[model samples]
Target: MTSMTMLEAINATLRDEMARDDRVLLLGQDVAQLGGVFRATEGLLERFGPDRVVDMPLAEAVIVGAAIGLAAAGLVPVAEMQFLGFSHQAFHQIGAQLARMRYRSQGRFPMPVVLRAPFGGGVRTPELHSEALEAQFVQSPGLQVVMPATAADAKGLLQTAIRQPDPVLFCEPLRGYRLVRDEVPDGDAPVPFGTARVAREGDDVTIIAWSAAVHVARRAADRLAEENISAAVLDLRTLVPLDEAGILDAVAATGRAVVVHEAPFTGGFGAEVVATISDGAFYSLEAPVARVCPPDTPYPAGKIEDYYLPSVERVVAAARATVKAP
Candidate 1:
C-alpha cells in the first residue's frame, strides 16, 4: 500500500510499464524535455532515454497518425494529447484509421495504442484544455474510453490501457490529479476494463458518475445520508466498455438513479446511462432517471466555470428529487 496523489500514481505507472516492457514508448509535445504539461512523464525521459521518450511536434494529427504506424509495426506507443479538447485535431486518425485498423486488416494488425489526455473543469486551464468530450470517443467503435477518479484506479487503469490490444482513450480528471489520493496496490496486475466500482452502498437512490464527478456523487451521498435518504454512489470507471451488469445491479438495488458528469446534458454520457437503465432495469425503477449536468453550451471560461460544472449541491438535489419522485 502506498499513499500517493493521482499524478504520482500515473507517473509511477508509466515508469513501471516502460521498465517492464521494452517495446513500450511515449511520444507527445513537451513530454520528454518538459516532462509533460502535467508532469505525468517527469522522469521517464531520463530513465528511458530519448529513443523511447521521443518528443513530438505540436500536431495532434501527425502524432496520432504516427502512433498508428508505430503500433502496426509492433511497438506499443502511448501518445499524449495534452488536453482532450485538442484530440479533435486527430479525430480522423483516431476515429477512422487507428480505430478500424484491426477490422480493416481482418485481425492481422493489432492497434495497441494508448492515447492519454487530462480533461474536466475545475483546473482553471485555458480554452480547449478542460473540455469533457468523452461522449464523442465513446461513439467510436473500436476505441475504449476510460476515466479514473482516484489515485489507485488511475494506476490500475493505465496499466490495463497500456497492455490492451485495442486502442484506448485514457481520460484523466484534471481536478483529481492533485486533489484525490489513495493507497494503490503494489503489483503489476492490471485492473480489467468494463468494471464499475461501488463508492458507497445504499437503497434509496443510485448516483452514477465517472471521472471527477464521482467525487461529487460521493459527497452528495454523504449529505443525503444526513437526511436519512440512503443513496448509493456508482463509479463507472470506463465508459466505452461500460459495465452493464454493475450499472443494472446498482440501479436495481436502489430503484432510483441520478446520472452525473462534468459534460453537457444533451448528448452527454449520462444520457447513455439513463437509456441503459431504461432498457435493462426499467421494471425495477421506481422513478424516472435524473441527470445532473451542465447545459449544452461551450465550456465557459474559468471565471464562471463553477456555474458550468456539476457540483455536489446539484447532485444532492437530483438524488433527492429522484428519491422523492412518485
Candidate 2:
C-alpha cells in the first residue's frame, strides 16, 4: 500500500490504465499542455504523447460529443469536464447522445466512455465550479455515476469505470483531491460499483453520504461516539447503481438514519437513499429518516459556505433529531 492523496491516486490510476490498455485515451480542455486544471492528468501528455492525450477546444458539448464518437469507433475516451457545474452546457450531448447510445443502438453500439469532473464545495470556487449536482447525473439512464471520497476508492473506482462497458460520470471531489489521503493498494484493483462501504460500524444510527460529505459524516460519527451514540457511516460510492442491500442492512441494524450531502435539501440524492430505506426497511426504522443538507439556494461564496454546506455539527444535530424522533 502507498500513502497518497486523492489526486495522486487518480493520476496514477489514469497512467496505469492507459499503459495497460492502449485503447484508453484522455481528452479535455487544457488536459494535454496544462495537465488539467487540478493537475490530475499531470505528466500524462509527456508519457502518452499528444495523440493519446489530446487537448480540445473550450467546449463541454464538443468534448463529450467527440468522446461519444471515439467510444463508438473503439477507443475508451476519458473526457474531463473541468467542473460539474459547467456540465450543464453539455447536458444534451451527455444525456441525449452519450447516455442513450447503447440503448438507442439496440445492442449494436457500446459507449465505454468516462466523463470526469471536479465537484462539491469547501474550496470556495467560483460559480459553476463547486456545485454538487450529482442528483442530476444519477437520473441519466445508462450513465453510471461514481463519486469517490477517499484516495484508494478514487483510483480503484476510476479503473473500474474505465474498464466497464457503459459510460461513467466520475465525480472527483475538489476539496478531497488533495485533502483526503489513504493507503492505496500497490497494484490496480477495481472497486466494483453498486457496493457501499461501511466507513464506521455502529448500531445507533446509519449515516449515509458520498464524496466530500463522507468525511463530514465520519467526523460527526466520531463526535457522536463521545456522547455514547454509536453511529454507522455508510459511503454510497456510486449513486446510479446504488448499493440498496448495504443501505438497507445498515439502516435496519440501527433502526434510524441520517443522510448528509452537500446539495440542496430538495431533489438531492439523499432523498433517494431515504426513499429506498423507507420502502425497504420501513418496519425496521425506529425514527423517521433525517437529512442534513443545504438550503434550496445557489452555491454560496467561500466565506459563508460553511452556513450552506453540511458540517459535522449539522450531521450530529440531524442524528440527534433522528434519535429523538419517536
How high is the lDDT of residue 175 in model 2?
Answer: 94
At residue 163, give the lDDT of candidate 1: 88
Q: Which segments of model 1 are wrong by more than 4 Å? A: none
Model 1 pairs in collision: none
Residue-by-residue lDDT tens digits, candidate 1, 42-130: 99999999999989989999999999999989999999998999999999999999888999999998899999999999978889989
Instruction: Give the count of colliding residue pairs in each prediction.
Output: 0, 0
- Tens-place lDDT per residue, model 2, 1-326, is 99999999999999999999999999999899999989999999999999999999999999999999999899999999999999999999999889999999997889999999999999978777889989998888999999898999999999899999999999999999999999999896899999999999998999999999999999999999998899999999999899999999999999999999999999999899999998999999999999999999999988999999998999999898887788
lDDT of 2 at 265: 91
Cα-based lDDT for every prediction: 0.93, 0.94
Give candidates' CA RMSD values in order. 0.7, 0.7
Assess every candidate by TM-score: 0.99, 0.99
